[model samples]
Target: MIAVGDKAPSFHLAASRDRVVDSGDLAGRPYLLYFYPKADTPGCTTQACGIQEALPQLGKLGLVVIGVSPDPVAQIDAFADKFNLEFPLASDPDHGLADAYGTWVEKKNYGRTYFGMERSSFLVGADGIVKNVWRKVKPEAHAVLVAEAASKL
Candidate 1:
């Protein structure tokens, strides 16, 4: 997994409006890159809404928020609309960006094992280096903690 002070990998993924979002496009700006398991799921919904609720504070810190998942564009759009999310939701259907950021991994649930996203978040600074990494994150309070970290930056 990525750690603090490591340079974040660059990626370009499809978002809403047929636009692509790239790490380079956010140069000179602090941003939050959060990875979730799937779209429209309960935990994912809670996490996204937490971030949405704190958008103003995050914006005050000059932070841009982008969510990523292996789900496709249509599901992403539906989830964003249902939650009234103001941030961009990037589609990483091939898990390319997730693999690059080390968010994809082996996971366990109900004594079953499978490969899935490891609910993680990265705080990337203006210079592109990872400022903080939250791996195996708890859904609740994740946004609050991430916002606090960005404030420290």
Candidate 2:
């Protein structure tokens, strides 16, 4: 997995049907790049909502939150709308970005094995270096933890 102090992987993906968010968009700004397994799921919803609720403080700290998931634009759109999520959520439907960041991995559940995104997050500093990383994150309280980290940045 990518670690703190490593340079973050560069990526460009669809944030919506018509909008694209790229690594360059995070230039000169500290940002949170989070990867969740799926959209509109219980855990993902909790994390997104927590971040949404903390936007004002995060904005004051000059941090931007960008979430990525292996879901299509339509599904991402629905999720954002349903939760009133203001942050941008880019789609990584092919797992390209997830793999690049090392968040894609093999897993076994209920005796079935498969490859999928592991819940993770990265705090990319304004210099484009990873300042912190969280792997296999618990959905609850994650946003709050990330927010505290952003404040320190």
Top candidate when judged by lDDT against the true structure: 1
lDDT of 2 at 19: 76
**Model 2 Cα shift for residue 18 (angstroms):** 3.4
What tens digits encode model 1's per-residue C-alpha lDDT throughout 1-153? 688999999999998546689988999999999999998899999999999999999999999999999999999999989999989999999999999989999988999999998899999999999999999899898988998899998
lDDT of 2 by residue, 1-153 (tens): 688899999989989546788899789999998999998999999988988998999999999888999999999998998888888999999999899899999999999999999999999999999999999888887888898899898
How close to the true structure is residue 30 of candidate 2, measured as C-alpha lDDT?
94
| Residue 84 lDDT, candidate 2, scale 0-100 | 86
> How accurate locally, in lDDT, is each candidate?
0.92, 0.91
Model 2, C-alpha of 44: deviation from truth (Å): 0.6
Give TM per candidate. 0.96, 0.96
- Consecutive 10-residue window with the lowest summed lDDT within model 2: 16-25
- TM for candidate 2 is 0.96
Q: Give the C-alpha miss distance for residue 133 in model 1, angstroms.
A: 0.4
